[model samples]
Target: MSRRRFTIRRPRGVAEYGAAALVAAAAVSLVVRLLVWVGEVLVRWWPVVAVLALLGIAVGAWRAAAAAREHTARAQRLSVLRFTLAEIDAMDDRQFEFALRDLLIRDGWSARQVGQQGDQAADVIAGHPTYGRIVVQAKHTKVAAKVGSQVMYQVKGTAGPVHRANSAVVVTNGSFTRDAREWGDRHTIGWADRERLRSWAELGVPLHQILQLPTLARRRLPGTRQPFPAPYERTAPEGRTNGVR
Candidate 1:
């Protein structure tokens, strides 16, 4: 059975107004009495209340400021990630190498590009303050293309030895195949995939700054090659006329 409940309607004239005003007055009186009680309490324990209140305010302000700073940092990182992804997507192979070198310099490295017609195409050579010297192999591939094991091996074998590098890294705008990544990991050769590269650009977190490989941090001993041998002045890669990408 369907049933409709009847609602009692309140008069919409002076009676409603009078009832509302009475309720309002009673509410105000209750609030006033509460405030009076608080005032009396405060008179007795004002020192304790003041100290607690001030401490609470300070803690709240510090937390709010910290949260605001963290929020701003996250927003800035997201903005940079967007711009970096766009640039990486558009850059050609040569542009990618030189750009990587520039990024290394910005993140506190003496960086240069290895320009050669045939040398396994080892891209950039840079020196890290903490990690010493490291050779780079840059691969600017389409997003879907996965860097394979053969290329990973070539760079792993060549980049470090050819330049007398303490360690080697392969930088890619595309991702690596599982086999390639595993091979590199086993050999202590590092790589930066697309998303990782974006974080590097966005957060100013350069690779050379973070690796914990004992060999990477210790090489370039007293008489050996300088951590940063003559940083080749920055320049566009050879045969670049069409501009970026």
Candidate 2:
């Protein structure tokens, strides 16, 4: 048997070159038609595309501005004020309550002054997203005149049942009587005398840290009823509109 071999050859002349040119021209024509269709479509819908792009940019800018404002407000709230003990002492009772309410707001609580006649021992009601609700009693008095245990008695009796407070505190610009301190300790009520108040108002110590209260597990005491649904007063300062969660 004889083995046969085959050889491949390139196109020889004009006929072959003309066929190749026809294929290339067809390809170019197809590409040009496709590009023309795309360009017409883009020209016809250019206004809509531009509007969508502008909308996207406006939405992104709005979100970024909102985030920046939130950050700035948070920083302003966290910044410590230059408060002095003399300033605190000079404040009237109502002014003192408002000052403490502002301090609570600075410390990230939605707080307002409620100290008035028939306030039920709650001078301030504050709510935190993490720590729940707290009631504060403010006493503005001279250093020589000390806050007594009666303040603690009043707070312990009414803070939970009347105001639905998770924690109760009495803050004073004067010293606390020994009996007052003991009473607050016994009942788990927090008392901040002049020095402690200075630390909180001036040094930016958070009230929760000073009170030593737990953050999570916002549970009521055994046999205690649920907190009142309408704990916040209608007049929330700084445009806060809602009650405690």
Candidate 3:
């Protein structure tokens, strides 16, 4: 059997090919100019040619720099997005409310938690003395079970009597209904959906730190079941005894 030899070919990108073509064109033009000079018929356009060449180099460098900056920005945004998702996943309903309130406070708003256990409409009331009062209803539902128009109306109704605020803001871990968003728009209410929450979390905190909260709790008590002791066990601790008394 005869063995066939395979040749490897290198691939060149458009930018690489374009740069090569530019260098080749410049070399060819220089050679042509040299030939014309030898024949004593060289054009007196050296200054113009020099300026064009400089312009071409500047444009190429600028394009390369712009492309690099775009790539870097995309990578940073992706990193931020991943960090935000991790933070969201680590948070429970109460923790999420705390995080949201912290973010609002960081943004220079005076935030106060209302009735955490049984709040009718708003979970938090945040305000800037100049920007007026803003009512915040922070919901930590799964992506599928999002707050809809009913919840929005409920909040609006509850907020009307509770506080005559300037604006009502619903911040949730999931998204809002299209109708809900439209209703908010019509009623001049603000909706901070999942994307906005994620963006804020990314800006305010790191993912590693957020994830570390649960990990730290688990590490503090190795091999321990939660709810500490079941409710039944708490009521009947003696029931588990093998012998009497």
Candidate 4:
């Protein structure tokens, strides 16, 4: 048996064939010249090129690692915030009020709880730097339930005559209605909306750390009574995916 040989066919026209061969030869020659030039450059400046290449690789790797770490940290913070939000929603009225008041105190306010009887709809009274005495009404609700105009009216009315507050603030673990927000904007009422609450939850030893495990108690360090686990474990809430979407 004879083996058939494969061959590349050329253009039949003489000028066309010559042009194609010349183009192909030129491309090959250019590639050869580029390779020779690269080799010569490398041989002449190998030390500098090697150092620069290593430096470039190191920089690229470092930047990539830094970006990845930042992304991971951001994801962890978001997770913690979401869990804290769910925990806030899970809180009862009194718990929610106290937490909000505590957050106020963390921000350098002399916050007091006044949500009991005769409190006049004011859950917290805070000494603001600018507003002097400010009142906050807390509403911890489902994400979809918006704080309506009635709540705003109560906020204004109770804060004005009853508490003699300088600023009436409406804080919610959820969101605010358009009318409620509009009224607040018009009346110079401060609002700690869900995003603000979420930001608060990201603070040191935040509500995420205070959350009860299945036993309705804070997850404590194994050897000690500390609510936080090891530093790494503290970054993520354990066994809870039912957080904000």
Of models 2 and 3, which has the larger TM-score?
Answer: 2
- Which lDDT tens digits does candidate 4 get at residues 1-245? 99999997768898988999999999999999999999999999999999999999999999999979756755655553333777787877777776666665544456666687777778877654333566778888888788888888877777768766666777788898888888877876767678877766543333222321012232332345533211211111234332334
Residues 36-109, candidate 2: write the lDDT tens digits. 99899779999988899899999999999997976675455445443568867777787778778778866777
Error of 4 at 207 (Å): 16
Best by TM-score: 1
Where model 4 places Cα greater than 4 Å from the true spot, the runs are 1-83, 129-131, 203-245
* Candidate 3 lDDT score at position 104: 53
| Candidate 3 worst ten-residue window by lDDT | 227-236
Error (Å) of candidate 3 at residue 15 is 40
Clash totals for all models, in order?
0, 0, 0, 0
lDDT of 2: 0.78
Indicate the residue-level lDDT of 231 in model 1.
Answer: 60
User: Per-prediction TM-score, please?
Assistant: 0.59, 0.58, 0.48, 0.49
**Scored by Cα lDDT, where does model 4 land?**
0.66
lDDT of 3 by residue, 1-245 (tens): 99999995543898877888898899999999989785553257766777888999999999999979756754554443333556565567766665565555545456666636668877777655445556778888887666789878977886656665556778887889899989987875677777776655554432222222122121111243431211221111222221111
**TM accuracy, model 4:** 0.49
